[model samples]
Target: MKEIDFSKLIVTLVQPLVQEPSAITVTERDTERYREYVLDVAATDVGRVIGRQGHVASALRTVVEGARNKHINAKKIRLVINDHRH
Candidate 1:
């Protein structure tokens, strides 16, 4: 399998979300092998990205996991949504 850099993968995946006009910020955290992403966006855009019952978030996690599996010492990926309140 091809090698991948976790940090770079994260930045690439999250960059688009922050580009949206209603998006506030994207924060990322890496701990050991796991990575956590928090996206702050306006309420309207939140539904657009998150999808019904979180299908979009699930898909994002799936993609991240696929990338993580190609790397060493990586296991978990998480995405959290904040309604631009903080």
Candidate 2:
């Protein structure tokens, strides 16, 4: 399996989330073998992206894992969705 850089992979996925009117912020915590991704998006957009019952988030996680598995040894990857609605 080819090794991948988790940090760069995260940035690539997160960059597009911020393009919409709603603000999207991503923070990453990196360790020797794992990385975590925290994604904060406007509440309105959250539904649009995450879908009903979190299917969207689950799909995204799958994609991330597939990509990561191809190259790097990742212990875990987390996606935290922050709602920005009042």
Candidate 3:
């Protein structure tokens, strides 16, 4: 299987769950110890992506962490969702 790009996948995962897909923006930053993915979405759609009780956000993080473990070594990756709708 062709390995997936977790950052891109993260963006794809969130785009559909949001109300304004065009407002969705993902930024990737790499550091010596970790890779950071910043997920930006409209405030109106923040609740939808985060889901009830944060289940959605947790799941998204889990998947990305899993993938990061498979590819990255001791280094790690993190997902940060930024909602600026309000």
Clashes of each: 0, 3, 1
> Which pairs of residues collide in candidate 2?
2-71, 3-71, 4-71
Flag the better candidate by lDDT, 1 or 3: 3
Runs in model 2 lying further than 4 Å from the true structure: 1-22, 31-34
- Give candidate 3 regions above 4 Å deviation: 1-3, 69-74
lDDT at position 18, candidate 2: 46
lDDT tens digits, residue span 12-59, model 2: 665564446436667777766667777776665777666689887787
Instruction: Report the candidate with higher TM-score, 1 versus 3.
Output: 3
Reference-based lDDT, each prediction: 0.63, 0.64, 0.80
Q: Which residue pairs of candidate 1 clash?
A: none
Candidate number of the best lDDT: 3
Model 1: how far residue 77 lies from native, Å: 1.7
lDDT for each residue of candidate 3 in 31-63, tens digit (9 for 90 to 100) = 887778888887788899889999999999988
Best by TM-score: 3
lDDT of 1 by residue, 1-86 (tens): 76666445645665565436534556778778667767666665776567689887677667867766635535476766675444
Q: Whose lDDT is higher: candidate 1's or candidate 2's?
A: 2
